[model samples]
Target: MDRPSSPAAPAAQNPVQLYGSFHLGEFELALPIDALQEVVTFPDAIARMPLAPAHLLGMFTLRGLLIPIVHLGSFLGLPNGTDHSEARIAVIASGDMRLGVLFDRTGEILRVSTGQIVPLRHGSESLGLIESAFHLGQRILQVLSADVLSRLPGLPHVLNPDLAQQASQRRMAQGSRHQAISFQVGGRPMALPMEAIHEIVRFPVLEHSVLADSRCRGWLQLRGRPVPVVDFASFLGLESCSTEAADGSDSEDLRRVMVLRRDDSYLGLLVDEVDSIVAYLGAQLLPMPAIRGQAGLFAGCISRCDTGAHDLILVSAPALLAEPYMAELAKGHHDLYLVADDELRDVETTRQRARETWVTFHLDRLMGLRIEQLCEVIDYDPTLVRPPGAPSHVRGVLNLRQTLITVIDLRSLYSMKEAEDLAASKILIVEHGGYKYGLVVDAVQNIVNIERAEKLRVPAMVANQLDTELRQDLREIVDLPDQTTIMLLDSVPLMQRLTGNGGGSTVVAALPERVVGQA
Candidate 1:
C-alpha cells in the first residue's frame, strides 16, 4: 500500500471561530457568537403585533428596547415553540432590524474551524437557510445563516416608500381598539377598560378610616397619599363576593386590587382576582343595556371570552368613576369632620355610619384585632428561647432577625383553651413606644369589613373573665353574616398590658446585635 501524502499547511491568517448553539425542536443549531446579542427569559406581557405573520411572535421589551421574537420552529417547518418555562428568547441583531429567536434552551459555545465544516451534498436537503453542517463524533450540528434568518417573511421585502406607508397606516388603524382586563368580582366576570386602569397590585395593608364611606371599603395610604378603595361588587349592587367564608370570617390570603384612574385621582378597585388582559374589536361589543338605575355602570357586554367560554360584563369607566361618586366620597369626609369634636356620641350612631375592618385570628373560636393598630405579621418559630421566670402569657423570646421579639401567647394571655398542635401558629407584631411585641395566635384569618351598624358592645358575661385592665382591651362584639360572632380586641391597650414592665425593651437589649433591624 502506498503511504498517504501529508496534508498541505495553510496560511496562518484564517483562525477558528466560536458559534453560539441552542436546541431547536429536535435538532441543535448554531449561529455566529458575534451575532448573538443576549438570551432573555420570556416577558410577562408581549404586545401583539397586528398584521404580522405567524412566524413573527410578538414585540417584547428587552433592556428598554422593543424587540420582536421570531418563531424559529415555524421557520424550520417544525411545531411552533410552546410557552414552556425552559423556553428562552435569543436576541440577534442584523443591521437596522433587531429581533429574537425562540429556542428550547441554550447549549454550549463550540469552537470550529473551516476545515472541520463538512459541506452537505448538493442533492441533500439541509434547508436553504442552513449553509453547512459540522460533524462532532456521532452528532451533526447545522450552522444557520444569520443574514438570511433575520429577514423574516412579510417584513419589508423592499425598502420602498409605498410599502412603508402601508405598514404605518395598518398600525394606526389598529391603535384605537380597546384593551380591557377581565376579572372576577363576586364570582361574576367583569372587565375594566385599559385606558381607565393605572395598574394591578396585590392587596395592600389598608389603614382603617372612620371617615370614609362603607361602600368605598376604606382608605389606603398609597405613596404618602390616601387613595380610597372601592368594593367592585358593592358598587355594582351585586352580592358581596368576599373571599372569606360567607360568615364574614377572617382570611390571610391576598386579594387582587386594580388601581383605576379617574381624572387626575386614582382609586383602588378591590376584586376577587384578575384574570387576563384581552383586546376587543369595536364591532364585537354589544350595545349597552339600559337597566333602570344600572345604565351608568354597564358600558357593553362582551358575548364570550377568547375561548368562547363565559360572557363578560364591561364596566363603564366613565360612569363607575363619575364626578357624583367623588362628590359622595367628599361629603363623607365633611360629615366626619363636622362631628369630630363630639367624643360622647352614641355608639349606635357611629355603628350606623362608620365602617371598621378587623384582622381576625383564632385562639379557640374566631377573634379579631383592630387592623389599624397592627404593625406587621411574622411567621412563628418553634425554636424560641424561654427566659427564666417568664409569665404564662410571655411564652418566650424569639430571635427574629436578631431583634429580640417577645412572644405572647394569646390563649395563655386570655386564659383560653390552647390547641394541641401550635406548629402553624403565627405571631402578630404590635408596636408601642418604639418597641415591638409578638402576639402568638392559633391561625391568622381573613380581613373582614363590618358596618358599624352591625357592631354590638362587648357583653358583660364575656367581660367578667378578665381584670379591669384586660377588660378594657375588649373593643366590641360583631355578628357576622354567617351567624358567627367575632370578639374584637384593641391592640394598643393589649400591647401596653403585655409590655408594661418594659420587658419588651429589655428583651430587645438581650437580643443579639443582628436582630436590631428585625422590624
Candidate 2:
C-alpha cells in the first residue's frame, strides 16, 4: 500500500484562517468563518415543503425570509441519532443563497495557518462538498465548501433579490401606517394609538375614595400622584370580562391598567389583558357603522387579523376625553390630587426634567443608547451588498428604500464573539452628519426611562478593561435595583469615530458604493 504524501509547508507570509467547527455524530466538520452567518437554536416550528427531497428538513422563517433547513446527517448517509432536542442550526451563505445545516453541537473557532491544511487528492468521493482536511490534535477536521453545499442537488435555493424587493415595498408603505397598542376590553378586541398611551402597569391595590363608583372603580397612587382608575367596560356599557370569582377572591393575573396622561391629569383604564402592539396601514381602517349609544367613541374599525375576519374597535382618545363624565373625573382628580399636594407637585416637576428615555440592547452585556439618537429599531437584514475593499467591522451596506445605509457590527468592533442568533438580532438605525448608519446588536431588550441621577461614571476597574475606543465612547453606567447594570454608549462620539472625525482611528474609510436600483 502506498502511503499518503505529507502536506507541503506554506509560505511564511500565509495568513491564519478562521474556521467555525461543529459536530455531526462522531465526525467533526468546519467551514470558513466568512461563509457562516450565525448559529441558532433548533426551531420549534417548521413548515414542511411539498415535494422536497428527503434530506430537506423543512423551511423556517429567519427575521422575515424563509430559510430551507437541511438534515446534514441524513444527506451524508449517517445513521440517525435517537435524540436531537438540543440540536442547533448553522446558517451558511453563498452569494444570494442561504442554507441551514443541522449539527449536534458547535465547537470552538479553529485558527489554522495554510500549512496545516492537506489538499484533497484526485478521485476523492466528496463530489466537491468536502474541500480539504486538517488535523487538530488527535481528530481530523473536514472543511466543507459553502458554494458546493449551496448548489447541492435537490436543495432549495433562497432567492434574496425577491425578498429584498418585498422589503422595499413594505418600506414604501410605512409612511401611511400607524402603530397601535392592542388590548382586550369587555371580551372584545380594541386598540388605541400608541402615542396616547403613557404606560401599562399591573392592577395595583386601590385606595377607597369618594370618587369610587360603577364607572370610577377607585384610585391608585402612581409615582407621586393619584390616578383615577375607571372600569373601562362599565364606562362603555359592556359586560365585565374580569376573571375574578363571584366569591370576591381576586384573580387579576392578566388584568392590566393602561394609563393615559394629558398634561398634569392622569387616568387609568382597567382592561382584561394587554395584547400585542400592531402596525396597520391607514387604508385598513374602515368607517364605523352606525350603532346605538357609545359607537361614536370609536373613530373606526380595523381588521385585527390578516383574513379580515376579526375586527378591532379603534378608540379615539379625543372622543373619550371629551365625554362629560371623563371631563368631570379629570377635573376631580386634578383638584383632589394636584392642587392640595404643593410639595409633591414641586418634586414631580423636578423629576420630570431629570427623566430620560433610553433604548437598551444586548452586546457582550446590557447596554443602552439614548432614544433621541436612534431613528428606529429593525430586524437585521441578511441580504446586504458587500462592496470591494470594505472594512472588517462593516458587515455590509443595506439598501433601505433608495438610500444606502452602512451596517457596523458592534461585536466585531468590540472584539466579542460573533452573534450566535442572527435571526434574533436587531439593528439600531442612527443618523449622524446627515447620513444614516445601522449598528448591529445581539437583541433589543426594552425601552426604559432612567433618571439622570441614576447614571454614574464608569468605574476605573471596569473602564481599564475596555478597549480604548470603546472606553472613550462610554458615557455612563446605570445600576437598577434588580442588580442589572447597563452601560450607556454616547452616540455622538461613537458616530464621530466611525466617520473619522473624532479620534485618530477610522472605523470605515468610506461609505460603500451605492448600487443603482438594488432594492
lDDT scores for all predictions?
0.63, 0.73
Task: List ranges where model 2 is wrong by over 4 Å.
Answer: 1-216, 221-227, 230-345, 510-519
Give one digit per residue, the lDDT tens place, for model 1 in 387-413. Answer: 766666667777644457677787776
Roughly what TM-score does model 2 have, to 2 decimal places? 0.46
Tell how far residue 297 is off in model 2, in angstroms: 16
The C-alpha TM-scores of every prediction are 0.38, 0.46
Q: Pick the candidate with the highest lDDT.
A: 2
CA displacement after TM-score superposition, residue 501 of candidate 1 (Å)? 8.1
- Per-residue error for 280 in candidate 1, Å, reads 16
Per-candidate clashes, comma-separated? 9, 0
- The ten-residue window of minimal lDDT in model 2 covers 1-10
Candidate 2 overall Cα lDDT vs. reference? 0.73
Clashing pairs in 1: 250-445, 250-446, 251-445, 251-446, 351-452, 351-453, 401-515, 402-515, 403-515
Deviation (Å) of 354 in candidate 1: 0.7
